[model samples]
Target: MSMLGTKWKLHGNGKTIRPGHVVAPEERLAWPLTIGIGMQHVVAMFGATFLVPIITGMPPATTLLFSGIGTLLFLVITKGRVPSYLGSSFAFIAPILASQQQFGVPGALGGVVLAGVVLALVGAVVQKFGAEWINRTMPPIVTGAIVALIGLNLAPAAKANFDKAPVTALATLVTIILVSVLFRGILGRLSILAGVVVGYFTAMARGEVDYSKMDAASWIGLPHFQTPEFHLGVVGLFVPVVLVLVAENVGHVKSVAAMTGRNLDDVSGRALMADGVATVLAGFGGGSGTTTYAENIGVMAATKVYSTAAYWVAGIFAILLSFSPKFGELIATVPAGVLGGAATMLYGMIGVLGVKIWVQNKVNFSNPINLTTAAVALIIGIADYTWTIGELKFTGIALGSAAALVVYHGMKGLARWRGTVAEPETETAGLPPAVKSAMNSAAKRSGKKP
Candidate 1:
């Protein structure tokens, strides 16, 4: 059992454990372990976390500062039920770039704040209907398709970076793979961190890194905070950014639930609210929007530790780190090629995780709607196609996801109206004996009957 799973113990004999009777441990995380695990969370999110500012032309330090503030606020709003480790959200990168080109930096932040509002609204909707509705409305087909779309949609942008900086990118990639595949124990766990370290040093030796500001910087100071100013000109751009971020928030919450062996219902709404509140706070702190990071979940799962306090420690350290201009400069100088190389595996893992989710959920595909929905979603999302309707231009995973939702549910609604699509037994019949056994075992472990 994972640490969190172990903490949630069934009081009676395991065979007859009743729902709502499980006991939670007094502490989800221990001390030294907490700081260490928190560091792991920090390292996991470092790469993509700073990318938002780099792309949007905001200071990297501002990104770090906001991420820390946002993360702390998210924890408070969620009543500390979720971890707080603020970082950059990739979902907002493209939109921030678009908004910047269209309306400048302030306009971009305005959009980001609006995106935060959209997330909060989504949370409100989820709260009203309840999480089971989200599951029922999403189903495996819809969520799975969206998950797949998430990675597929980003592939082209990654490839463009790779093409622009092949050698540096390859070095970063090789280092990441080396650490992941060749290293062991703590080293293995920190493969991405180690790879970035090695790649950064390598770049520095080649004069690719510029760290002249290290000597001119103060060791400690308060971060420069900027307030957000909104305008109507960029509302459209910001709204979509927020919608896409909401989709990402859904995925992140689901991932954490899977990691903790809890139902998605346990934390989805609270987590969404946390991310939304974090973004609002981040705006006040003069930083970018924040979201839950799946990487930290991976660390928690591996360490079997789930301590909000540990995340608090990590959050404090992040805030401290954010105040140093020299530190931000160092983080900024990391070779983009190295980032691209590391991203190849990182992004690919995200795609694979989507497939794993579908497998875990035992999504039925025999039905025409199920197969068609997943298939079309993967194609359109991965291929990066878009269409505009009136003032809205929908494309990428956002478009693919919207399309899948429409096709699957709309067809089902139509069937109810005209009697066509029906649930079929064979939709789930293809799983081999081994997979069924594994899934059944998982269900048992999770205290659920198959």
Candidate 2:
């Protein structure tokens, strides 16, 4: 079998490819079509990638450069089998910001590096035992709840962005929905990019866009890179984020598996390891922590293109664009409302994906154990509930994830203990003698032996 080429045979007119057919990782379309699809992935990732730097006070260009570098690295580590894009991780935002205030940017970088190391260690454990252990520890109910929690946790940020400019945000959201629902093939797949472009022009027409940044930006420039300074205290502060990263990566892999109809359990460890290494590399270069991007996953879902080659092309394009200050400025000029609108859709889909996982797995919600686990996880994650132990903190997705595991397992163990001694069959014992005799007689008559 070929590792990296078209697996499907063309029939009739080879020029026309059918809709809903996944273009596999090893496959390639004509260069022009492939490049356009790659560009769509870049556009899908742009908002979140730059937003991290804007929030954390890191240079946007550096973040973009590292995002590209990290994605390429991830592709290499996963053997180009996984179709994922590495983007700035919002999971590390709170911890990184807190570390920055306490220690400096270098210190925050140190913390990020440490977090990466922790994730790498976890990846090692995953590789050794395989994903089955993780699945058992975090079953569909728990994983589904945790995944849904990620989306619910980000709802406020999406809303805040929308509130900044409601009109443009609504327009962007509506345009995306219309294009996705009404259009077919590539046009439908490019809905996110189309929405952003439409919303951007709409914002510009309304004089909401600031042109000064773009005008002042030089056509060519290099990203400002910073070196990390290791501090034990700061490093310790960010380690908890590893949990969130693991949960996110696992969910991302599962989602992609469902989309691609491929079994990715074998590559789960490699994917996590890649993400960890990428995060460490990004931290070394003064970039935000990186994670598998759900935004791009949404694009893949819409486009039906799971080609790893497209991600490689997108990464190269991002790297090239990162050297252009003009390009960075142009991306920056995307209105907050437009970004928010896109985020709303992307995040909501991620949440729905968790629901999809539960549905696919046939999680029995009627079981009190399953219901309780999901309930507690959702409430804690959605509420942004937090806990502190000494200098370590657990909150939002991290806390929700931990809670789901502990609650589900604890309830299961308790239930097992309570039922250790199986009760005798009680149906006959509780039935009236006449009815029982009648049932026995009917059984004997039907079977000759009861």
Candidate 3:
């Protein structure tokens, strides 16, 4: 038999069976092993699990419960094709908080739920128009700007937390830095976890840690599932926020595909669908919008483990933890100072990622229009404290993102009209094998063989 068709023989003439068939090496992991590594992903994303609730004024335990259930639903919807753990995204924090303060929690939740639906709509668009269309509409420059806005908008929250107890926050920050700098192996990989642990102990030593809540917590029971209430005013407030989540979902799809060496369709179409749908489910279950967790990507990158099944394991763990009031209390008890120090790193990383995207895309700086678009966008995004348009008010990072998208696209359009920038070419459609063969034959006949 040819090598291509051959199977290995073992035990003195019999071929031994190969382990994996169609699945990626990592994808074929057993349930136990998958769960083991999956738990690591959960741990990595734990901080952000309840952060959405805290920021948006929803109950923290309810958020945690839905996060777990939403993740599992996401996996089921995706048919377990992608190995991503879903969690509350930081991108919505600014808008949700603003909406909550302006409208109320129900209104914010409505917006978040609407955001999930928007993501689902984006997925349909991706299916119909194809990835190239998405690539064209929201190029690297646009995404970078949005990502920059996401981080910059979050600056106030981090600063507010840090200012509450600068000394304690600094101590936590020091611990995080020390672990990141000095640790190795699992210790280094879990530097965030270690920092939280160390900071918790340090605060305890200083008699600053509060354990009063732990005593009030029950030993076991399900989360308080909430029924959503509808309001037009709340829904309207969240509409823009939903639009932003759609952009974030696109980024998540891109990030997973880049990290996993898979095409977006090949990697996780169903998964993306699940991410959106599960988020809707989460909202109904009294939670916020869910997206693929970026922190878990860090764990996978470090361990070089890419098993989709591992996320299922993490999902199960999350579900169990959700029902445990003590677990909820523990997660809730993490000091804001600890969160602040980490946020300094986490939020800044978002900005740095934006810079990376901008630099790598080689954004056309030579063109005055390009320069103006980028400069204005950055200025508006980073320092947007006020704007009023004939009565309607707009400010902060959302304004910045909206401005960047409009300005960049408008400039590009103007440049096209003036014949300064060439018109964009349509991406080539798929070519079947027979068509390829026919084209090749015609080319050979014309002495232009390829």
- Pick by TM-score: which candidate is best? 3
- What does the lDDT read for residue 204 in candidate 2? 89
Candidate 2 per-residue C-alpha lDDT over 316-404 given as tens digits, one digit per residue, 9 for 90 to 100: 99999889988777776777888778777866865786787788776767556778888998888778787666655566666777788
Mark the regions of model 3 whose C-alpha exceeds 4 Å error after superposition: 1-27, 55-57, 184-186, 229-261, 266-269, 386-393, 420-450
TM-score: which is higher, 1 or 3?
3
TM-score of each: 0.77, 0.75, 0.80
Error of 1 at 424 (Å): 3.7
Q: What is the full ranking by lDDT, best candidate first?
A: 2, 1, 3
The 0-to-1 C-alpha lDDT of every candidate, in the order given, reads 0.65, 0.77, 0.64
The sequence of per-residue lDDT tens digits that candidate 3 reaches over residues 1-450 is: 112211212221112224332223234344455557778878887766665665455666677777777777765555554556778877767766766665566666666777677667666666655556656666777767767766776777888877766676787778878887897655665666666677667667777667777778897987766665555544433444544455555666666666767776643345545667877777777777777776776677666665556666777788887887776666667677767776776677777777776676666454455566667767776775556555344656656767767887887666555555421221112568776556545533442212
Q: What residue pairs are clashing in model 2?
A: none
Least well predicted 10-residue stretch by lDDT in candidate 2? 419-428
Q: Write the per-residue lDDT of candidate 1 for residues 85-179, one digit (tens) a residue.
A: 66777666555655566567776777677777777877877766765666666676676677667666667666876776777777777888888
TM-score computed on alpha carbons, candidate 1: 0.77
Model 2, which residues run further than 4 Å from truth? Answer: 1-41, 47-58, 89-112, 226-265, 293-310, 420-450
Off by over 4 Å in 1: 1-37, 51-57, 184-186, 212-218, 221-267, 284-286, 386-392, 422-427, 430-450
